[model samples]
Target chain A: MPEQLVFAMEVTLNGLMAGVLYALVALGFVLIYKASGIFNYAQGVMALFAAMTLVGIMNGQVPFAHLINAIFGTHVHEFGWSVPGFVAILLTLAVMVLLAWAVQRFVMRHLVGQEPIILFMATIGLAFFLEGVADLMWGSEIKTLDVGLPQGINLWIDETTFQIFDYGFFIDNLDIVATLIAALLVIALVAFSQYTKQGRAMRAVADDHQAALSVGISLNFIWVMVWSVAGFVALVAGIMWGTKSGVQFSLSLIALKALPVLMLGGFTSIPGAIVGGLIIGVGEKLFEFALGPALGGATENWFAYVLALIFLVFRPQGLFGEKIIERV
Target chain B: MLDAAQTTDVQAETLLEVNNIEVIYNHVILVLKGVSLTVPKGGITALLGGNGAGKTTTLKAVSNLLHSERGEVTKGSIRYRGESIHASDPADLVEKGVIQVMEGRHCFEHLTVEENLLTGAYTRKDGNAAIQQDLDLVYNYFPRLKERRRSQAGYTSGGEQQMVAMGRALMSRPETILLDEPSMGLAPQLVEEIFGIVKDLNEKEGVSFLLAEQNTNVALRFAHYGYILESGRVVMDGPAAELRENPDVKEFYLGMSDEGRKSFRDVRSYRRRKRWL
Candidate 1:
C-alpha cells in the first residue's frame, strides 16, 4: 500500500510536468485564435521552425544549404562560424518576429473577416508552408541542442520526500525549471491582459473585432502583435521540447498533444490552458501507470483524447470556455 | 426679443456632415442611396428608422467601418470638424474625436467592465490622470457600472452592458459620438436610464450626438432635431416636436393614429399607401 501510494505521487508529479509543456504549446494556439479567430494549426510547426532556426543559427549551418548544393552541385552546410546559445536564441526570436509580420502582411491581412472554418483551413495550409520552409532552410536533419538547461534528479526533493516514505520521490531538475518558468509565464500573461492598455485591446478584439475597431484599436496591429507574441511562445515551447529530446521534425507533432489540452481547458481562456494542461498531463500519466497493463499497455496515447471526447459530449464549451448562449 | 429657444437655434454649428453619400455593399447592392445628414455641434441629432432602413449603415459610413462589411461609400463625402474623413480608417476617425458606439452592445465580454471602459481610451495619448478622471466621470453617470465594475462584461445584465457601452464611449473624450440602438432589447426602465445618461452627457459635457434609434418616441424626446429615413432616403427632416406631432409619424412610427382605431390589416395597407417618401 505504501509503495503504491509513493508510485502514484511520482506519476502525478511527472504527469503535471508533461502537462505544463502541453499548456506552453497550447498557449500559442490560444493567443492567435483569440486575436484573429484563426485556429492556427501552424502553431506546432512554428515551434519546430523556431527550434530549427535556433539550432541552425547556433551551429552556423548555411540557410538552404541543401537546396543550394542540389542546384549548384556544391557541398556547403556551414556558415563558417557558430554563435553563442543566447545570441542564437535572440536571432531566432528576430526571425520569428519577421515571419509573424510577413504572415500578417501576406496572408492574415487579406483573410480578415473570413469565416471561422475558412480561417482555420488557411492555417492548415500555413502549417504546411511553414514546415516546408523550415525543412528547406535548415535541411531535414536532427540535431542535439544544449542550451545549459538543468538535467538529472532533484536530490533535495528526493531527500525531502524520502523522509515521508521508505521510497524517495523521483523528479528531474529540467522539469522543475520548466514548471517554474511556466508559472512565471502564466503570471506575466495574466498581468499583461489585465493591466496593460494593449492587452485590454487584445481582449476586446477577441470579444468582438468590430467593437475593438470602433474603440480605436487597430485590428491589423493587434493581429500582428498577437502573432508575434504567439511566435515568441512557440520559440519558448520549442526550446523546452528540443532540450528534452532533440531538435527534429517530430517536435512539431507536440502540437497534436496540445489539442486535447485546449479541449479540456477552453481555447480562449489563458488560465484554461494551464488547468487543462495539468489535468490532461496528470490524467494520462496516472491512467497509463495504474491501468496500462490491464488495457494492453500504452494507454497514455489516447486517454487524454478520450477524456476530452467525453467533455465535448457533456460540456462542449470546455471548463473555462465562454458559455455559448445562442440568440435568435 | 426672440424666444430663448429661437436664440439657441440660431447658433446651429455643423460638426459632422455627410453630403449626398451613396454606399454600395458587395459591389452590387446599393445600401445607402444618396444619404445625406448633418450633426450640429453641441446638439443631439437623431436618425430614426425601423429595421433595414440604413440607420446603422449611415453611422458605419461616417465611422469608415463599412469596408469591413464590403460596403463602400461610392459617392459623396463625410467631413468631420470641417475635414474630409470619408477615406480615414475607423481608428483614425476615433483619433479625430469621432467615435461610434455600435449597435448590439458590443462590449468585451471576457474583460471586466472597468477594463472595457479603459479600452475606450486607447487612442488618447493623454496621461493616466485624465483617463482616470474620465473613468470617474463615467462611473458618476452610470453608478451601476461602478457597483459592477469588477464583474466580467459578459456576465452583466443587458441594462448594465448598455451602460458599459455608453460609458465606454464617454471614456474616448469625443467631440461627437455616433450612437446606434441604445434602446434595443432593454426594459423600459433601463432604456429610460440609458437615455437619461445620454441627455446628461449631451447637456453637461456638450458632446455632439448622431444617434440611430428605432425607438422614435424616446429618441425624439431627447433629440433637438430628427431625420426619418425610408428605403435609404431621408423621407422627412424636421425639429423633434414637429415630427412627434406629424400625423404620418404618429400613425406609422409611434403606433398611434389620430383617425381613431384601425385594424392590423388596415395599418399594413396604410403603411403601403401613406408612403411619406
Candidate 2:
C-alpha cells in the first residue's frame, strides 16, 4: 500500500468529520430560515455566545459567582467551584433557551411583517450585539473546553496497517464518533419535524406566515422553539469543535462555512444541509490535501464557497428547494 | 316545491347577520358604509356589485380578516348563531364552523393537496381517524383532487385549485362557509361545475354558504336570496326569483338586451386579444 493513498484516506475521513460540524451549523440556519424567512446571519454568533456562556458558567464567572456569593458569600469558594460537565451543559442549554426567547420577544417580535432584507439586517445587528455580549461576559480570550469526551485515537488494526488488495486506508475513532453523532441528530430532527404538533406548526409557519397565523399557529412560539433547538445544535457543534481545537471566536468563523452549505443545500432543506455539508467537507479536505502543495497550503479557506458558487449557477433553487412558479 | 313549514324553519335559523357595519381602511377611506345583511342557514346568498362596491369588504368583515390595520369594522356588529363574533380571531371563527375561502384560492402552493387539506384541520383536536374521515368526504365531493392528492397545489389548474381551497375550508367541518368569487377565473363550464358543487354541498351536506359573486345571472340561479350593491351600498335585496324577474336589475346588470351584451363582449374580447398579442 502506498503512503500517499493512506494519507488521502486520512484526509477524506478528516473532511467528513469537519463536514459533520458544518452540517450542525447549517442545520441551525435551515431551522431559522424555515420558520421565518430571515437568513439569521447571527446564527454563528449565537453558537459562539452559547459556547462562551457554557465556559463562563463552568468557570464561576462574575454573574454566576456573584449570585452564589450573595447567597453563601465566603463559603461559596470552599463548596467546590467545579460543576459537573453535564450540569454545566444543561445550564448552558437553559441560558440558550432563555436568550432565544428574549431574542424573539424583544428583537424579532417588533420586526414582524417587515421585509426579508430588513429582517436579515436585524439578525446581522443581533449577531454583533451577541458577539459583544459574549466578549463582555467571557472576555475575548480562547478557553479550553473539557466536555469528558475521550481524546486521542483508538485504532481497530495495530500500527495503521490495513491492506485491501494493495490499497490501504486509515481510520480514526474521533471521526467515527462525529459521524455517529451527526447521523443521530439528523434522525432526531427528522422525527421531531414529522411527529410532533409543534414541528408541524413550524413547517406550516415556514410555508406561509399569514396562513399559519390564520390557522391559529402562534408565530412567536414557533420562532422561539426553532431558535432554542438551533441553539442546542450549536452547543453540540461547539462541544465537538471546542474539544477538537479550543473554544474561541474562531468557532464563529467556522460557522460561516454553513452559508455555502446552505447555498448548496437550499436554505429550507434539512436533509440538503447535511448532504451539502459532507460534500463541502470532503471536497475541501481532498482539495487541501491533494492541491494544497501547489496553492501554497491553504485551499480549505475558499473551497466551500467556490463549490457553492458553482452549484448556484446550475441549481439556483437549490438541490431540494421547492420549485417556485410565478403566476403574474 | 318545498313545504311552507320547512321554509319557515330554514328562515328561522339565521346563519349570519351583519348589522350596520362600517369598515374604514387605514383609518381613512370608508370601504363599507353601514352595510347590513342576513344569510339563511341553507342555500346560497349572493353579494353582487362592481369591484369597489364593498362586497369583498363585507365578506372580510364577517371572517375577521379585515381589522384596524388593513380595514376596520368601525360600527355595528357581525353575529353568527346569535353570538356577536365581531372581535373573533380568524382561526377561532374557523373553529366555530365559520370558514372563509378567500377571494383568490390562496392554496399553499408548496404543499401537496392532502397537506393543504390537513392545514384546514389545524385547529381540530380530533385524532387522525376523524381527519381521515373528513378527507374522504372532501375527496368524494371533488374526485379530481383525490386523484391529485399527492401533487403540489402549484401545478393544479385554477379550477382545481379552487376545489382544493373549498375542500380545505370544508376540512375544518365548517357548518357555514364563506366563498368569495369561486368562479372568478374559471371558464364558463368550470364556473357551472363549481356552482354545481356549491349547490350539492348545500343540499347534501347541509353546509351553509354566503357566496359573493360578480355574475348576477349565475348567482341568482343558485342563491335562494340575493343582495345588489351599487357603489358600496345595498341598492336592492329580495328573493332570488323575485330579483331575477325585476326589469330594472335585468336591464342594468343581467343584460336583457342582446345588443348591449354583444358590445360588452366585443370590447372585452378586444382588450383580451390586445393583452394576449
Candidate 3:
C-alpha cells in the first residue's frame, strides 16, 4: 500500500474507535429521548458523575468528605481501604440506579404531560444541579481512573502492519477494547428493546403515551427503567473516557460533541446513533487529515458540526429517524 | 327487531356505571357536567354527541385516562363491576379489562401493526400463548391488519390505523372497550366495515363496547342502547330502537323532520327551541 493510503486507513481506523465513544454517549441520549422525549442535556454530566462516583468508590473516599470535614473541623477523606475495581463498579451502578429513581420521582413525575420544551428546560436545570452535586461530593478534583483495561498501543498490530507495508500503523489497545465493548452493548440493547415485553411498552410510550397508558403500561416504571439503562450506558462511557483522559469537569463537555452526532444519526434511533457516530468520527478525522495543512490546522473540532448542519438543512428527520407520517 | 329477552339480559348486567360525573380540564374548563351513562355486558352502548359535547371526556372518565390531560372527575363516581374506579390509574383499569381506544387513532406509528397489537397485551399476565391466540383472533377480525402486520402503522390508512387501535385494545382481552370516534376520517364504506366488525366482536367474542361517536345514524343502527350528549349533558337516553325513532333525533341528528328532510337553516329556530335542553 502507498504511504498516504496506509496513513489515511490508519486515521480512518482510529476515527472509528473515537466514533464508538461518541456513539456510547449518544446512546444514553437516544434512550432517554426515545422513551421520554427529553433531549437529556444532563447526559454528559451523567457520564462525568458516574466516572467520579466510580473513582470515589474505588479509592474508598468518604462521600461528601469536604462537607464532613467542614462540619467536624477535622480531616477525613478515604476510608483507608481500596475496594476491588469490579466491586466498585457494581456499587457505582447501584448509585446510578438510585440517581435514576430520584430523577424520575422528583423531576419527571411532576412534569408528566408537559410540553417538550418544558421537559427540556427541567433537564437543563437537572444538568446544572447534577454537575454541582458531583463537584461538591468529589471535591472538583481531576482523578485518574484505572479500570484494569489494557492501555497504550498494540505491538501485535504494529509489527504485523510493519511486515506487510514496511510501515507501522498506530492503534491504541484501549480504543480496540472500547470498540468491542460498544459493539456488544449495542447488540445487547437492540436485542432487549426488540424482543422484551417492557421494550415494546417503552416504544409504545414513546410513540403515544395515552395509548400506552390505556394498554396498562405504567409510565413511571418505564421511565425509571429507561433512565437506569441510560445511566448504565453513561457509566460505560465514563469508564472509557476517564481511562483515556482523567475524570474532570471537562469530561461533561463531550455531550456537546454528541449533539452533532445525534443530529446526524437522529435522536430517536439507537443504530442511528452508532452509524451517525461512525460517520461523523471518520468524516471529521479524514477532513482534518486531508485539508488541515491548508486550513491552518484543527478543523476536526468544527467539521462534525458543519456536516451535521448540512444534514439538518437537507434530511432533518435524520438518517434513521422515523419520518413524521402525516395524512392529509 | 328489539328482542325482549336480550333487552332484559342487557339491563340485568351493568358492566360499567358512570353516575352523574363532572370532568373539568386544567381545573376550570368543565367538559362533562353531571353526565352519566352505563355499559351493559355483551352490549354495544353508544355515547352519541356532536364535537365538544363531552363524549370523549365521558369515556376518558370511565377509563381513568382524564388525569394525564389535567382533566379530573370532580363529582360523582365511575364504577366497573360495582367497584369504584374513579381514582384508579388507567393501567389498573386495563388490568380490570377496561381499555380506551383514544380519539385520532393513537397507534404507535413507528411500530409494526403486529407490535402495536402486542402492546395492548402489556397488562395481560395470561402468558404468551394466550396473547398469541388473541393476536390470531384479532388478525381474523381485522384481516387487513394481518395483511399489513409487518408494515409501519403510521403508513397505514386512517381506517387501518383505527383498526390497529381497536385491534390493540382487543389484545388485552378486555371485557369492555371504550372506543372513541372509530368512524372519524374514514370513508362511509370503511365506517360501515368497522362498525360491522364491532358488531361481530360484540356478538361472537362477547366483548362489550361503550363507543363515543358523532355519526348518530350509524351509532343508532348498531348500538344496543344510546345516550345523546349535548354540550356536557345527556339530553336523551333510550334503547337504540326507541332513539332511532325519536322525532327530535330524526329532525336534529338524522336531518329528517316530520315535514321531510330539513336543512340547518330550516332547523335553526327548532334547534334554539330544543325542548330537552
TM-score to true structure, per model: 0.94, 0.87, 0.98
DockQ of the candidate models in sequence:
0.65, 0.33, 0.85
Candidate 2 lDDT, B194-236, residue by residue in tens: 9999988988899988989998888888887789886667888
Model 2: how far is B103 from its true place, Å? 2.6
For model 3 chain B, give the 10-residue run with minimal summed lDDT: B1-10
TM-score: model 2 vs. ground truth: 0.87
RMSD of each: 2.6, 5.0, 1.5
Question: Ten consecutive residues with minimal summed lDDT in candidate 1 chain B?
Answer: B1-10
- Candidate 1, residues A112-194, lDDT tens digits: the string is 66688988888899999999999999988889887788988999989998887767888988888888888988889889877
- What are the per-residue Cα lDDT tens digits for candidate 3 across A267-320? 999999999999988998899999998999999889999999999999997999
DockQ of 1: 0.65
Best candidate according to DockQ: 3
Residues B60-139 of candidate 1: C-alpha lDDT, one tens digit per residue: 99998888878889999998878999899999988889899989999988789999999999999989999999999999
Name the candidate, 1 or 3, with the larger lDDT value.
Answer: 3
Q: At residue B66, what lDDT does model 2 achieve?
A: 69
Better model by TM-score: candidate 2 vs candidate 3: 3
Looking at model 2, the pairs that clash are: none
Going through the candidates in order, state the TM-score of chain A alone for each one. 0.96, 0.90, 0.99
For A1-328, candidate 2 gives per-residue lDDT tens digits of: 5678778877787788788889888998898888887898888888788777777778766543444556776434323376778999999999989989999998987776667999999998998898888876667779888777766765543244444424334555655677788899989998888667677778777777666655555677889999999889888877777777788997888768998998888888889899889889999999998899999988889988999899889998678766665565
